[model samples]
Target: MCDFTVAVFRPDDDRLEDAVELLESLGATPVPDPMLAVEPTGASPRDDADYTILTSKTGAELVAGAYPGTDSDGVADGGARTDRWNPGEATLCAVGPKTADALRERGYDPEIVPQEYTSSGLVAALEDRVDGARVEVARSDHGSPVLLEGLEAAGAYVHETVLYRLVRPEGSGDSTELAAAGGLDVACFTSSLTVTNWLEAADERGVRDAALEGLSNATVGVIGEPTGETAVAAGIDVDLVASEATFETLATETVELAAPTYYE
Candidate 1:
């Protein structure tokens, strides 16, 4: 078994568990240290139309709760008209399978999803169809600009709806976590905010060197290229990137890349 322990900074417990499972299956130990907390956006829902794009699962869940009882699937409640989402007829683009599955479970079938599962990939996939189309993006308040910008540049009338927000976890001592991270081998960053929060936490904990050294020594795995870029900018050497920008793919690649230090 590999002696190295992989550190994960995902906020969700279920996602953390999934990553841990993948690492353990490959004999690599996992240490979860979530830096950011996700919360629902207080924004009210707007009228729906032909195309609705779900960018993240959290956003989907928020919309589902806001629009309760509208769909039989119980995913979306009642904000927008359900009849507008004609499944195979209307086009719905999702950033990842999780978001796509969320839509599916809610009674809306997505027609377009990127193979790479990143904002850029999703934008690229929808560029052709988005031209001159009316598109609504359901996403977090802190979502990336790539999707919205790309769609607008492609002549699509894009309306972005905030569904959630990411903030620093309350009562979590950033400095303490960073100080403790010195013993960790790998630091996994899933989002840009995670990178920012982790740096702040490390600085607060007075373990910047430990965090930096750990990141430099061990592989820094990221879910997408944007996140990888953030790590590189923070002086963390990235070793592996998920082929598809999903937690499952991230875990899979993380285990495979760290397999040299792990046992089956």
Candidate 2:
């Protein structure tokens, strides 16, 4: 029996580690070759507002410092503001358990709402709460305006703070890492950017066809609907989608889909 190989495109080592551990436990091997690199934006802090909206774990980590007693996992210090709107109930909201646990460790019991775990879900959840409140959105420097835009459209006072930036991984001379992913049994794309970066890297390495072919035979898993759409746009058929928009769920579903082939 051949060892099932899975390609993970997330650039965060911590995330990559968690995915790899999950896949391995399910009888799959992870091929580590990230396509994106997370860079901090160094944006100055804005005024403390009524509400703080965090979309990504990266953003959570950056602003985690601002909310002292907030651990790396998004936990807030006891007695700190705890009415913040955490999309995934703090767990699946930002990055993964670590971020959620961090928030809890600090002292916050995030308001978890049952819904799709994504920026859109967060927006929908905030519609009623932020209609006339001042909300501050903290995100990556290159983050999208989707969340903030939606908030304002819903009559909320939205202020944005850039916390980080995402760029192509540095020191990677070429897209060789992507080219080598051609033989994997499954390719997991966590974000729309991951899809773009993967394809871009493939094109740069002149292995577009190879990458596509590799994807064709294997299952393509996406973290969210938008990411799934991005994969479809890239001409890769997504076979599985994580129930929740989180890397952990994405990897779990990917492993489950490919289990028959690799796991007994």
**Candidate 1 per-residue C-alpha lDDT over 70-174 given as tens digits, one digit per residue, 9 for 90 to 100:** 355333333433233232344677887898887778776778888767778878888887788888887777788998899899889988877656787755444
Put down candidate 2 lDDT per residue, 1-264, tens digits, no spaces.
337777887765676677778778767778777777765544433545556655655555545453333454444444233223333321222323445565566454444442656667777777777788777766766555677788798898877766556776854313334434656787788888878877777777777877787678787788877888988988898999889877777888887877786545
List candidate 1 segments past 4 Å from native.
66-90, 171-182, 261-264
Model 1: lDDT to the true structure: 0.69
RMSD of 1: 4.6
Deviating ranges (above 4 Å) for candidate 2: 65-98, 106-114, 171-182, 262-264
The superposed Cα distance between candidate 1 and the true structure at residue 197, in angstroms, equals 1.1
TM-score of 1: 0.83
